[model samples]
Target: MRLLITGGAGFIGANFVHSSVRVHPEDSLTVLDAMTYAGSRESLAAVENDIRLVQGDITDAELANKLVAESDAVVHFAAETHVDNALADPEPFLRANVIGTFTVLEAVRAHGVRLHHVSTDEVYGDLELGNARRFTESTPYNPSSPYSSTKAASDMLVRAWVRSYGVRATISNCSNNYGPYQHVEKFIPRQITNVLTGRRPKLYGSGTNVRDWIHVDDHNSAVRRILADGQIGRTYLIGAEEERDNLSVMRAILRLMDRDPDDFDHVADRAGHDLRYAIDPSALYDELGWAPKHTDFEDGLRATIDWYRDNETWWGPLKDATEAKYEGRGQ
Candidate 1:
């Protein structure tokens, strides 16, 4: 089997590629990434030569069509992922997340390749009432920000292709992911690297925002399953159910690094930030026979922190840029 993964040089996507290649040696992988600032080659250093790496924007229909034509399956992960990045200027988000997705859908329709649309739980906005039923496959999308609106739009487009062209498709909306090869601009690694080198972790507002986090490996496993046996047009919610507030998650990371809790900075809240994004993966568990293998947040945090600590050179240059930019990419 040959798979084409967009945004393969980015954090979760790169980890997925590494994990997939290690597990399925017989399967060939092709990664198409634009190599944006957030999409670093360092994450994919080990597999650059092993897997074909095509550097091009997904909005280019010609490139997208060519890549899809060469693969057995297409995993759509290319998008301007940050909420602030999207809010700052939504044009790029629309072009990449929405139009870029359409480009992929058209290519797959022409090439007869299966598609797994990698989506996010943020598409279902804040649920301020009633037990907060985990956002399931049936949850109606209520996107609260530009980032999520584009993703929701793309998700709708994928469904359109499934109905209009009889294309095989599966959508997985995963929770916030935290693991190795992440840029320092993200919350977890930003905090860990900041305190480790005597910088303050800058957090937004009250830090009360809630999110469920999953290990990248666990997410990769779910994607593999969706590719293997998921029914066409099925939407799977992939998460570890390890829900934690932003403040709590940061403190937990501090505990892992044996650092003082005071080594942090709090600021005004971001515009249009959702209070919580929780999802129920019971449907995927019931139907796909898949459950999270690493549900322990503490153990996952330990391993993630150790990965950054051991590989300083990989994420070292990113620390100053993270602080100078006053930007972060997680809950």
Candidate 2:
């Protein structure tokens, strides 16, 4: 199969691209990425020779149309995904997440190609801490931040196209992902890189915010499963059911790195920070027989730490600037 993977040089997308090359050697892969500050070519270094990487904006309708016209399937992953960045300025998020998705929707609609839209569970907003309820396929949209609102809009666009234009598309909303090639601005990688660089980890607010964490590889595997066997016009939630609070996760990182658990500093939390997010991936499992392999969160963290430790050259250049941006926000 010939596949067009948008944003394939970004964190989860890069991992997906690598896995595609390793697992589906018979398939030809092409990656379209804008190489934004959050994305880097170095992330695709290992699989650079295995796939074709196109550096272009997804909002370019002509480019999106040309690529979609030649592909068997298109996995759309390009977007401005950082909450902090979106909070600072929402214009880019509107352009990338909304307009870019519109472009992709039109292309796939025009070409009669299958499409899988990758989304985040944040679009369901946050559940109260200690709530037993988790987000499922039936959850209503209640996006909190500009970043999530844009993603919610994109997801809506896919659903609308599927109904209105008969576009062959499916959607998967995933929980928080942590693994290699992730940007330093994200929570887990920021803390891990801080420890490796001799800086204390920073926790937000009381550190009670809970997030359902899943390894990137596991997330990508579930996505592949959906693309292969999932029913059209259905939305599946992907999660490993690994729920951890910020404080506990930070303490675990500190303990694993041989530091005092309470050595971390507390920073002001961002406005509209969701108290918790949990996902129930029952539909993904029961309907598609998909299950996450990285069930052990600590083990995943250890491997992730090792990756960042060994690949300092890949993350080091962006550390200072990332921290500086956070510092400005007092978070």
TM-score of each: 0.96, 0.99
CA lDDT, every model vs. true structure: 0.87, 0.95
Q: How many collisions per candidate?
A: 0, 0
Q: Give the 10-residue window scoring lowest on summed lDDT in candidate 1.
A: 322-331
Best by TM-score: 2
lDDT of 2 by residue, 1-331 (tens): 9999999999999999999999999999999999999789999998898999999999999999999999999998898999989999999999999999999999999999999999999999999988899998998999999999999999999999999999999999999999999999999999999999998899999999999999999999999999999999999999999999999999999999889999999999889899999999998899889888888899999999999999999999999999998988897
lDDT of 2 at 21: 95
lDDT of candidate 2? 0.95
Candidate 1 — which residues are off by over 4 angstroms? 327-331
List candidate 2 segments past 4 Å from native. Answer: none
